[model samples]
Target: MSDSTTLVYKKKKKKFKIFPLVNAIFFIIVACLIMIPIYRVIISSIDANTSYNFVWLPSKFTWGGYTAVLTRSSLYTPFLISVVTTIIGTFVGLLVVTLGGYVLIQWEMPGRNFFAYMLLFTMIFDGGMIPKYLVIKQLGLMNTLWAVILPMSINVYNLVLMRNFFEGIPESLFEAAQIDGCSPMGIFFKIVLPLSKAALASIGLMFAVSFWNDYTNFKLYITKNKLFNFQIQLRNMVIDSDIPVDDAVNQETIGNAATIIAILPFMIIYPFCQKYFVQGVNVGAVKE
Candidate 1:
């Protein structure tokens, strides 16, 4: 290469490097800000003192808190409830959203746009707490796990994202499937779904996170202690000052452990889905 050309290429490479470095620094700062608070929560839970004093590390660490809370027969029950709810909610919710999105994009059903609009409207505006509660009560779903799962089965944003993805698929593929004697169901199960795996996995993770973190629905509808989700249980421990710490060995430590444990599942799952998550968000956010 000529000297001028080589110099220009070097300058461009340096400029590109600068931008990535700037982005890396920003990312690190944001990550540290987020991690610090979480670390403090973990620390506080393990700390012996109840005071809100700042500490970089726990003065003393003990697993007594974890054992005390976890050993209770009732404690494990809520964990079970949370796991079941998360799994069911994620699966059912993703299935419905994916199917619905596919139908909206591929099928020439009547009032499709209107229905899409309605779904989008719900995302924008809700019936508020009282009316939603009444609806749940009237349906006789209150105090059941169904209350948590049923209401949020289809997230409109995810539906729209999937719909967009489906729209992007070549119509020739569907036509070929039809010619091959494939029913709509067969096409969906065999072709469309397999092709849509990335989007599905992405939305599934989103649904899983939402269900895992939900506490309001459980708090309002679940009267049974055994039915409490992890978030609800965590909230009870954190908010209820009157709950006797002495009753549970090393209550502070246990609380910290629970806080860390509560978030650990999502932390583990996030990295796996992160690439798909970014792609999903970009594709889903694309306006039709």
Candidate 2:
């Protein structure tokens, strides 16, 4: 074959690959699977007709379910408690992870390898529920908001992600800060922390969502309903048959409405941080 013809044939063969199409098809199917359940919940939430409709769309729509959930005073307290605990937990978790990440990347820090190995060890094998409970009880944190906040304070995976991002920062910057008479603490607070916002934001979002959705902690450590967070409260409403029926909608409709309410905040907030989240995840994902 002529060289020009061979090049064109080769280019054509390279351009027409099945991988992209296969990937696209796979994602589309997965997307449909995810969306269908969400769609059903939404439809069911708004449907107040009190009749079973297996159709794609609801025959009638009403806001009774939403009103039923929103007007309840019991739901309001847990919502506020969740907001407080999530904010506190996310801030504390992020702070600890960021500092730990910084320390992990420091070559001269003594026992760094040992600590890193210990961190990894916890991720692989944790003290079981009974042990954790005993520790909490010993700390006198049981039945308090701190019980939930402190146990999940630092996720090892997030710490590792932050460490990876810190490793990617230029060593020259740290050296320059030291030359300017800046202590390691000052460098971390001013230079390192400021530069690590992308990783911090990404991990912060993860921590916030985790703290927001934590029901097991509340169920296990917190017996007092007044101290419960929104998810735990919602769990009780759903499973305990304790939801008030005096509202316009039935129990099932209210549960669907509660589900949407619970998930709506994350859905609304995710798009705003999505770019930073993706950037952080990708930036730390590789190493030289």
Candidate 3:
């Protein structure tokens, strides 16, 4: 090649080496590294005892684990309980957080900063388990689904994210709505909310994941076996080895399967909202 052509090729190569392509490759590598264990868990769940040893690939695959856990496992009741709790908790928590966040951002209500600071304080410092338990007891919520939902209804960090999103909306739109004699509630429902779909979906998914993965609350307040969440059931399965096996329950493989099943919903839902999640994170990271 001519010297000039060689020099031009070297310049282009240098520019390519400095591009974000390197960072993207690095990110993919790190992501795959993190996901390997999760992938293994899913694989293990689909296979039977062939996975007992540390083989990288399963020699045989079966639906036994899923069938065992979903149909015949003793913990099926708890799985149902978890589904109910997650649904109820996510719905209630999302409504409360979004509505409260919207109000706090909009009204400039008296003592708003104090309330916000108090909420932020909770993020840093928690009432210890005992105190929180006592309060739940005092409220007569123990052994009830409300016990799970009420104490954690509004996460301060999530509220802050939602507030930032609300703040990002054009104030002029709100003003125009006000001139049309729209009430705060009407404006929130009709105008602000439609525009804030991305933020809401992101926050809702976060809350759903939190509620789904939570075992501590259920373990603490729900003494009744019927009230145990899926995490609690999985914990019990992992701890006890001699659990009964029926025609549908492959007791030997249920733990691994349960772990996979527990995480599958989040895996399915996250991709759909991933764009919104990134946007929400970037927007929330910036202080208004």
On TM-score, the candidate that comes out on top is 2
Give the range where candidate 3 is weakest over 10 consecutive residues by summed lDDT: 242-251
Minimal lDDT window, size 10, model 2: 49-58
| Model 1 regions more than 4 Å off | 1-18, 49-51, 241-251, 284-288
lDDT of 2: 0.87
The list of candidate 3 runs beyond 4 A from truth reads 1-14, 17-21, 51-53, 245-252, 284-288
lDDT of each residue in 1-288, candidate 3, tens digit only: 999999999987854465588889999999999988777777677666534555566656678877666664666777777778778877887788788788778555898888888888989998898999999999998899889887767677878878887887878888999999999999999997888778878787878888888888988899987788778877776667545564543554677777788888888988988988877776445443
Estimate every model's Cα lDDT from 0 to 1: 0.79, 0.87, 0.78
Model 3 TM-score?
Answer: 0.84
Ranking by TM-score: 2, 1, 3
lDDT over C-alpha atoms for residue 209 of model 2: 95
**True-vs-predicted CA distance for residue 263, candidate 2, Å:** 0.7
Which residue segments of model 2 deviate by more than 4 Å?
1-14, 50-54, 246-248
Local distance difference test, candidate 3? 0.78
